[model samples]
Target: MKRSRELQEELDSDSETAGTQPTIRPVFKVTQLDSAIDDELDSFAMRCNLPPHREALAFKTYDEYEVHYNKSHTNRCLECRKNFPSEHLLNVHIEECHDPLVTVKREKGEHTYSCFVEGCERKCMTHQKRRMHLIDKHMYPKNFFFAVTRDGIDGLSAPRESPRG
Candidate 1:
């Protein structure tokens, strides 16, 4: 009842402020103290369906020591076959225990690049090889040029002779 009176006073003050700021009042009415108490009691009842003061329900033959021992002993390193002091130790063991052959068997192939020239089909295993291919097969000196000549029924065009001797 006291809480309800206090809440009513608060609502009245809020309504007074709502005249100047029409949006100040809450969209819904606040819960009455009696209903709030009832709701709390219902939630408490649901939570305490089991006895509040009683010890936790036990298994038919609960053995906590065996459970702990099994948990502590079962989590061990496969390679070392020894119980690790903690998960960090187990991770370290796994990282250190990898077989050399496994590393070799999982090796990745060397990096390679395709020639950047338009029609070139050469593949090189490194940048240096690709550069050499470009210089040897694609690049040309500035003076390099094909000479055009007039053909007079010859098999292939010969350089045009200097006009008249």
Candidate 2:
């Protein structure tokens, strides 16, 4: 979509070529769009009672949320009924303590990961294995990542995406 004249002018004003003709382009760049989405997500989280201390934090990329979630929230593990010293400690406990059974291989600078579903420890060590695992087990959007660390299966990339059942 085209940017409004005033917004375009404002953006052009910040450029090094101040006197040169401004190049009018789409108002929202990919990074800007991503930031907007993250803002919306933060708003949603806030409405859902995200703690006050976390409200001011900014998540730059969606994947960072995975890392953040893994690092934060160290209270009692609701699933395993385990208590931790702190929420952050509890989060670490969960990631380190639980074994998702997945494996990861680094070969020729490429990464090969696995799908360690219960009763089906299928290793995605090859192309065919990866496809079969995605189709037969995780039939979600193709863009989604399992977010399962090599052996630890306790963390999630997104709140909606759960560990293999």
RMSD of each: 32.3, 20.6
* Each model's lDDT: 0.42, 0.47
lDDT of 1 at 126: 51
Candidate 1, run of 10 with poorest lDDT: 145-154
Model 1 per-residue lDDT tens digits across residues 1-165: 244665677777877977664233344577666988776555432221122225433322236534534434544555545544344334433433454543343354343344444344565655456556655677633232111111111122331221111
Indicate the worst ten consecutive residues by lDDT in candidate 2.
Answer: 44-53
lDDT of 1 at 87: 49
lDDT of 1 at 161: 24
Candidate closest to the true structure, highest lDDT = 2
User: Model 2, range 82-163, lDDT digits (tens) per residue?
Assistant: 4333343344445434534322123432334344343445545554556567666767455544332322233443333433
